[model samples]
Structure formats: structure tokens, C-alpha cells
Target: MHVPDGFINAPVSAVAGVVAAGAVAVSLKGARRELNERTAPLAGLVAAFIFAVQMLNFPVAAGTSGHLLGGALAAILVGPFTGILCISVVLLMQGILFADGGLTALGVNILDMGVVTSVVAYALFRGLVRVLPRTRRSMTAASFVAALISVPAAAVAFTLMYWIGGTTDIPIGKVFTAMVGVHVLIGIGEAAITALTVGAVVAVRPDLVYGARGLTAPLKLRIDGELVDAPAPAPAREPAAAHRSTKGLWATGLVTALVLAGFVSYYASANPDGLEKVATDQGIDKKAKDHASKDSPLADYGVKDVSNARISGGLAGIIGVGATLVVGSGAFYVVSRRRTDDESVNSDSRRDEKV
Candidate 1:
């Protein structure tokens, strides 16, 4: 849920900002491992895709609508650290360009949506997958359950935050009940979309799914009529970890994300999402402040010069895709470089000792 600028008080917003900043900093370090040659580039696409999908608001209740929070989907497809980065990127873009999330409340949105959802969902998904059957079906099933829970978990987080920093004097218990109840319905849509997308991708290329990396059973061979385990291979392809060239997957994913955000975002549903609806209904919008960038040319996804909604939104979405890729890819490249440097230093030390 994108909380606008005025809903949360200054103290709460400032605290959230620090927390969000810290989270991004930590994720940058964690992402060094998560964003490799394959996943680094893929991370940007994940952000863009989440942005596009978020545009499609599914009806959660009679009036309230819900959209993909995308934490579970990103975590399952990418890794948890990168997933947080991905969603945070979208939130940042939306806040600055689209006048969506408030700049002042950026930390709150990131903490509530990015940190809580990704970390909680990934942890649950990993725990369930560890004990469940080692099948793609099981992976998809776990994704569904994890996604289902993450939404409500986010709602709870928000409720707690509001209890602390909420501008209104409304009872905390009522707010919690309302927030959780509406979000439960919203979670279903999230779970279904996550499960289907994960299942389809896993079926096509399980190798690309970060959460499924070690979960797949080895490919069994059929010798004549008997079932047999394949013979072990040389170190070129170590069984210790089945490493695949992430380059191909990264390219394909990036291309798909560009197509979706640049060309396909035009078709996304135009409606207020769950948080927006609740805020309006609960009168939380009374104190909301105007976005600082509301005057920006591209504010609300409309390019200043473009008159056509179709063209304007399309162009903005495309620009976002390109920008996110460039920035995200650069961040990831730095991490990859550090990782390589560390590995090289280690290798050099061993050689020096031998010499």
C-alpha cells in the first residue's frame, strides 16, 4: 500500500526514512551475492515488472481493490535481498515520477511494503519448501501460501506503524481489524497471480528461479527399463551447485519486462488500490499533503508534451524501465565486482603461500 505524504506524522515519517535508508544499505551488501552475472541484470526487470503489474488493480471487495505487492513473486523469481531492492526501486520511481508514494513517506512505504513483505515471504517460502516435496508443484504451492500470508503481514505492519505515527485519533484496534480484514481478500489475488507466474516460469526454466535453485530433484535417467540416477559429472559442472549461465535468463527477463512496462502498462487497470481506498474511507486522506513533485512534467505518468494518455503513460513506463535497468544494473555490477575481487584476493593469498 502506497502511503501518501500526509497520512503519517513527521516523526513517524522521519523514523521510517532512517529505517528505509538502513534497509537499502543492508540490501546493497546482501544484493552483491544475490545479483550475479545472471541475477543482477534480472533484478531491474523484476522491479519494472512489479511496477507494471501493480497497475492492474483487482477487485478485492465490493469497493476496495487490491494489486500485487510483488514481494513474494520477486523473492521467488530473484532472491530476497534483490527482491527488496526491486520493490523499493518501483516505490522510489513511483514516488518521484508518478507522484504515487510520498517522498516524505518513502521510508514508511519501503519498510511496510518492501522490507516486511520480502523478508517475511522469503523466510516462510524457504521454510515451507525445505520440508515440502521437492517438486515444482510444491514450490508453486509454497509460493501461494507465502504470498497469501505476506499481504496480511504487511497490513499488520502498517497498522502497528500507524498506531505509533498515525495522525488520527482513531482506535488502533479498529484500524487493525479493518486493515487486516480487507487485506485478507486482497491476499488471495496476490497469491493466485504469484503461484501461476512462478509455476509457469518454473515449468519453463526452473534454473532461473532463485528460490527454486536447490529445490529441484536431479534429473533421473532411464536405463533400458529401469530407473537410474545419472552418473556424476566432472568439476566443470559441479554437483555441489548446479550453476547455469544466468546471462540468457537475464536477457530474456529484461526484454520481457521492457515489453510489459513500456508497451503493456497502458492496459493496466485504472483504479485506487487497497490502501488508497481504505484511506479515503477511513478519512485518513484529510491530512494528506500534496506530493512535492506534483508539478513535475511526468507527474502521474503523463509526459508534459504528450497529450494522449496512451502515449504519455507508455512513454513514462518505458523511461522508468530503462532508468531502473541502468541504475539497478550498475549497482549490481558493483556488487559482482566486489565479490570477484574478494575471490581473487583469496586465490592470490593461497598461491603466495604455496610459492
Candidate 2:
């Protein structure tokens, strides 16, 4: 949910800003280990895909709708650290470019949506994968459960934040109950989207899905009438055909994102999302302030002076997807480059020691 400005007080919002910044810093470091030649660009594509899918809000209740939070899907497709970055990039773009999320409440949105969802979902996903059968089906199931829980977890986090710094005097209990209740329905939507997306990726390129990695059981051999693990295969250089396949996958993913955002988004539900519904019902928006970029050309996911609703929204969505891809890819590229540089330095140091 995109928390608008003035929902949280200055002090609590500032503290949340600090916490979000620290989390982003930590994720940047952790992402160095997750991003590389094969996965870095895929991570960027995941961000763009998440941005696109989020535009297609599905009806959850009578008037409330829900969209992909992308935490579980991203974490399953990429890694948790990079997943956090992906969501953060989307949030940042929405705030500054689309005026969808408030600038003042950026930290709150990032903490509630990006950090909490990714961390909780990834941890639960790992646990479930360990317990369930190691198969693509199991990965998809784990993704569903993880995403189902992550939405409510984010709702709980926002409730706690409101309890501490809510501008209105609405009873915390009512807010929590309404928030959790509506979001529980929203979580079902989240779970379905996550499961389908994860399953599709696992089917096409299991190697690209971080959570699907290592699910394949090692080969077994019978020697001297005793079962034994076969020797692990040595790492082999990626063949040119595999490289072409990866390129094909990337092209396909980008095209899919473009289609989803550019055209399909026009038919998405127009109802308010889970958080907006809850806020309006509970008087949480009594003190909500206007977004600073409300006058931006692309504000409210529409182009300025564009009479055609379909065209305006379509252009905005396309712009958002493109901007997110560029910024996300650049960020991941830097992280991946840093990792390569570190490895080169370490190798050099070891060689000098031997000399």
C-alpha cells in the first residue's frame, strides 16, 4: 500500500526513514552476492514485471481491490536482497514520477511494502521449501503461502506504525481489524499472482529462479551393493546456445511487461486498493495531505491534458516500466560489478601470497 503524506507524524516518519535507509544499505551489500552476469539483468526485468503486474489490480472484496506486492514473486525469482531493491525502485519511481505514493511517506511505504514483505516472505519461503518436497511444484506452493502471509504482515506493520503515529484518533483496534481483514482477502490475490508467476518462470528457466536452485536431487550410484552419492559435476562454461536462450528469455520477459503495462492495464479494476479502502473506512485519511507531485504530468497514472483515459494511462504505465527497468538495471549492474572487482582483487592477493 502506498502511504500518503500526513498519515504518520513527523517524528515517526523520520525514524522510519532512517530505518528504511539502513535496510536499503544492508540490502545493497547483500545484493553484491546475489547479482551477477546471468542474474543481474533478470533482476531488473523482475522489477519491471512487478511494476507492470501491480497496475492490474484485481477485485478482492465488495469495493476493495488488490495487486501484486511482488515481494514473494521477486524473492522466489531472484534473491531476497535484490527483491527488496526491486520493490524499492518501484516505490521510488511511483513516488517521484507517478505521484502515486507520497514523497513524505516514502520511508513508511518502503518499510511496510518493500522491507517487511520481502524479509518475511523470503524467510517463510525458505522454511517451507526445506520442509516440502524439493520440486518446482513445491516452490510454487511455497511462493503462494509466503505471498499470502506477506500481505497481512505488511498490514500488521502499517497498523503498528499508525498506532504510534497515526494523525487521527481512530481506535487502533478498529484500524488493525479492518486493515487485516481487507488485506487477508487481498493476500489471496497476491498468492495466486505469485504462484502463477513463479510456476511460469520455474518452467521456462529454473536456473534463473533463485529459490528453485538446488531443488534437483543429486545423482545416486550403487557401488559394491551400497548406495552412494555420485561425484558432483564440475562447473562448465555456459554454451553459446544457452546464452542465446537467456537473451530470448530476457526479450520475452520485457515484451510481456510492455504488454501488461501498456495495454492490459487499461482494463484493470478501478476500485480502491486494500489500504485505501481501509483508510477511508476507518477515517485514517482524515489528515492525509496531497501528494507533492500531484501536478506532475504523469500524476495519478495519467498523462497531463490527455483526454483519452486509455491512452493517458497506457503512456504513464509504459513510462513507469521503462524508468524502473533503467534505474533498476543500473543499480544491479553496479552491485554486480563491485562483486566482480572484489573477486579479481582477492584472486590477485592470493596469487601474490603464493609468489
Candidate 3:
């Protein structure tokens, strides 16, 4: 959930800001390993996709609604480092451009929404992969479980943060119960999206999915008497993409995101998300402050010129898609370039040593 300004007190918010800064710093280095020629571009689109899916708030309870948190989906599709960066970029864009999340509470949002979910989801996914059958189905199963846990983990994290630096005097137990209860329902939705998305990618292009790197078990061979493990074959220099038309995938994905955010949001459940619902129900939202971007021309996804909220929202949705792609592609490009340079240096060093 996007934590608005003033929900958390100044000191706790500052601590979260520092934590968020450190996470981003670590991700920059970690991304050097994750981003490759193939994955870098896809990572950006993953961010936009997350942003889009988040707009479609499915009904969780009678009133409460939940949306995709996307940490597991991103981590399964891309790499963990890039997944964190993807979510971080979405959070940044939402805060500054859409005025959805709070400026002052940006750190809180990043730490809970970015750091908690990515770290937990990836860690769990890896652990499950080791024990589960090494197959695409197993990967999807792991993704579902990982995503399910990550959502509640975020809710718990927020509850803890609120207890420490809550602007209001609401009891900690109440926050915990409410946050956990609502987010549990939300987690189911996240799990479904993550499993389906991971399954789809792994079905077509398992090579492109970072989490499925070693999913195919090594072949066992037998000659004459005893069975032996076959030596691993070298990967092809350049594997052809499974699909004949990537243009279709891109078009379908982008269109789905735009439709979800711009038009479908109109039908989204009106109940506040887990965080907002808990905060307001428990009186924590009393201290919430107006977003700094309140005066901006595009505040709340409504364009200035478009009288129809639908048209204004639709235009903003398209703009968000373009912006996320542009920024995400640019960031991943730098990461990919650095990776290339490192590989070159390593190769040269090995040659010199051998000489």
C-alpha cells in the first residue's frame, strides 16, 4: 500500500528513508549481475506491468479490495536485484508523478513495498526450488507461495513501523490484526498473478526467466552397467526466442496494463487498501497530510484539459506506461553496459594470466 505523508512520525520516517537509500544502493551493485542483454529491457517492462496490475483492485472481502504486489512476479521473471529496482521505480513514479504515495513517506513505502516483498519473495522462492521438483510447474508453485507470504510480510512490517512511529495513539495489536487480516486476502490475488505470469513465461521462454535458470534437471545416462550423470552441455551462443512474434506479447501486455489502469480502475472496489483501511478504521489516518503534488496539473491521474475523468485517466495511464518504459529501459541499459565491461575485463585478465 502507498503510505501517505504524516502517517509515520518524523523519526521513524527518517529511519525508513535511510533504509530505502541503502537498499537502492545495494540494488545498483546487485543489478550488475542480474541485467544482461536480454533481461535488462524486460525488467523495465516488468515495472510498468506491475504498475498497471496494481491499478486493478480486485475485491478481497465484502468491502476491502486488494491488488498485485508483484514482488514475486518480478523476481521470477527478472532477477531479484532488478525486481527490487523495478518496484522502486514504480514507487518513485507513483509518488512524484501520480501523487498516489506520499512524498514524506516515500521511504516507508519503498522499505515495505520494495525491500520487504522482494527480499522475502526471492528468498522463499529459492528455498522452495531446492526442495521442490525441478520443473516449470514447481517454479510456478514456488512463486505462488512466495508471493502469498510476501504480502502478509509487508503488512506486518507496516504494523511494526507504525507501532514504533505512529502519528496516532492507536493500539499496536489492533493495527496488527487489521493489517494481517486484510492483507491475507490480498495475498491470494498476488499469488495467482505471480504463478500465472511465471508459468506463461516459463512455458514459452524459460531461458528469459531468471528464476528458472536451473529448472531442467540434468539427464541421467547409462552405458553397459551403471548409470552416470551426463556432462552438462554448453548453452547455445544465442537461443532463438520461442515466439515468432514478440511484438504481439508487447502489444498485448502494454494494452492490458493501460486498460487496467485507465478504464478498469473506474470499476475497482472503493474500499481502501489494507493499509488505508486499517489506518482510517483505527484512527491512524487522522494525521495523514495532503500530498505535496496536490496542486500539480496531473495530480490523482486526472489531466487538466480532459473533462471526462475516463479520458483524463486513460491519457495518464498511457503516459505512465511510456514514462516507466523510458526510465526503466534507461536504468537497465546502464546496468547492462557495466556488466559487459566487467565481462570484457575478466576475459582480458584471464588471457594475460594464461600468456
How accurate locally, in lDDT, is each candidate? 0.80, 0.88, 0.82
- Best-to-worst order by lDDT is 2, 3, 1
State the lDDT of candidate 1 residue by residue for 15-76, as single tens digits: 99999999999987887776665456667777777777776677777767888999989888
Record all residue pairs in model 3 with backbone atoms less than 3 Å apart, i.e. clashing.
Answer: none
User: Which candidate number would show the highest lDDT if scored against the true structure?
Assistant: 2
Kindly list the per-residue Cα lDDT of model 2 for residues 1-355, writing each as its tens digit.
8899989998999999999999999999999988897778889999999999999999988988989888888887889899999999999999999998888898999899999999999999988987876556677889999999999999999999999999999999999999999899989999998999888776666667787556456323445776555443223674676778778889999999999999999999999998899889989999999999998999988999999999999999999999999999998999999999999999999999999
List candidate 3 segments past 4 Å from native.
Answer: 215-248
Judge candidate 3 against the unseen true structure and give its global Cα lDDT, from 0 to 1: 0.82
lDDT of 2 at 282: 86
Best by TM-score: 2
- Local distance difference test, candidate 1: 0.80
